[model samples]
Target: MQGHRPSQKQLYDHFAPKMLGVCYRYARTLQEAEDFLQEAFITVFRKLDQYRNEGPLGKWIYRIVINTCINGIRARCRFSDTAGRIDVEHLENESTAHPAAHSEIIELVRQLPTVYMTVFNLHAVEGYPHEDIAKMLDTNVNTVRSQYSRARTLLMKKLGSGPKTNENGKRG
Candidate 1:
């Protein structure tokens, strides 16, 4: 059904759940996620005409949601002094190790600090290159790499994976 057009309601109904999940990954609270969802949908409808069918509608909406979330994070970071200083020790203590599972991984990711979480989600989950991520976040490539590294380290520690090892089983 490439280029098939759907009504606004149809589009919202079809994509809301998945897009809310995307918002939830970036929001610190359920309320914030809902807010992001609402705001993103508003943007989606306003820009509906801009969707040129170059890609799947779902992918297009997903990009809008991600951009909305990133913008939200940037705004929050701008106003909050503690934005980048979330206490890792507290998060680690509150988190539990579970077998590799989708929900478990999402929960682990949610515990990450905002900066690290954004970088991790963009680079690892969304398959964006570090260079692209750097440009998107308006930061240097080295900073993106540092944040991604810290994010992985935090996630591994939270999941009780200790430290990662190289192919030869030596610690990285």
Candidate 2:
């Protein structure tokens, strides 16, 4: 996962069982969980490496069976409604909100600490693999993964709460 790329079958064989357990955690049904696996595979195959194997969906579906396995977390992040903001509190007051607040979300992304913003952008926005981001940052893959995870956690925390300092780290 970190160095040389592996084949899709190889990836599937190695990680499918574990990931299916994850997919089953929040998905409505077994089939839905399988669908999540496929979707997760397709997403990672297309976004992470962009390589193709000429099997099934062809070469574009290569190795990347790890990081994107947790789809439930991203989809189930709870948020409180706040006008022009996403907060982590339970709001007693309901305010009118636009359907898509792209700017507000972008602002939150921008407000991430430098490392988080950089890793988040590189991985989520730029579609780089964690290894690639690690290489770019001169660090190990776990560190990159940790930063990205923390970034997502922070963003989820701020979904309706607006930016708040991470008690465990530098201000973001």
Candidate 3:
């Protein structure tokens, strides 16, 4: 069972950027994302031997990244009450230069409550099913659905419906 081990360097080279993207989505800053990614990588390495290979390695790494992001959020919230709640009013109509961080839509998503953020990211961004999210977050399936509904409502208010076509199916 212990005859062969996955190459650590190969693992890093394969998953680092994608995992970092997961970390960055839930983090407020690049430094925070880097820290989260580092911590997540440690966990991945520790649990590497437990990986059963039933699914893709990227999926396994994604779960680790998500858990790490949640842990980082919890740790920050422990020290400061302001960790989860940030005012986005002042950030409205801001320039949308940066693709991920500075994007108004992404900023709005980041402003959502932690539970909502997690649910939203898993559902909308990561394409996880409500049942899976319920299992992962230890909540009821209905709760996951409700959270996604609420998240979508909030997102619509912030990001607007996508561009509308004309009644005849031509450009508006």
Candidate 4:
């Protein structure tokens, strides 16, 4: 895929759909997910020579996609939060987007605040550990854990399945 348009297009075609799903898990809208997909592919092509060929190409491409998502979050979040922090601002203009049909749960995930959604997708959907998430986000482990906790709580509450705890935080 290096310096070859047809090969690049072929690779993109083969991976774009699944990679877009990966992007969507971390993006708020379809447009944002598409943008991330394009960006990742661009990076993939640029770094094709660095692939050591020790692993499956799809896994390598997936790593690029994940890195692209995290980098996108970092780039957009820097202005909202301090350096070395992953806390991000809510999308003020998100209400204008008319998303195409997708899963109810996916839409609910997208409804979360950017930081919570990112942490949640990285840890839960991607099967990454909290420690890895903290490293990826350049944040403390406890912060990632709390963010994951908050994300789960929010999702459960939205799903009407939050822990059935009483006033004292015990099971009802």
- The C-alpha RMSD of each candidate to the native structure, in angstroms, is 7.9, 14.7, 9.5, 8.2
The TM-scores, one per candidate, come to: 0.76, 0.38, 0.65, 0.80
How many collisions per candidate? 0, 14, 0, 0
lDDT of 3 by residue, 4-84 (tens): 346776778788998888887888788999999999988888887899999998888888899888778777753111211
Candidate 2 structure quality by residue, lDDT tens digits, 25-133:
3344578668777887767645644444445432233223223423332354322121112232222122225435555655666676555655665677557899986
Report, for every candidate in turn, its global Cα lDDT versus the true structure: 0.77, 0.55, 0.71, 0.77
Candidate 4 residues 27-88, lDDT tens each? 87789989999999999999999999999999999999998998998887741221111111
Stretches > 4 Å off in candidate 2:
1-100, 161-172
Global local distance difference test of model 4: 0.77
Error of 1 at 136 (Å): 1.3
Q: Say which candidate scores most in TM-score.
A: 4
Worst 10 residues of 1 by lDDT: 79-88
Candidate 3 differs from the real structure by a C-alpha RMSD in angstroms, to one decimal, of 9.5
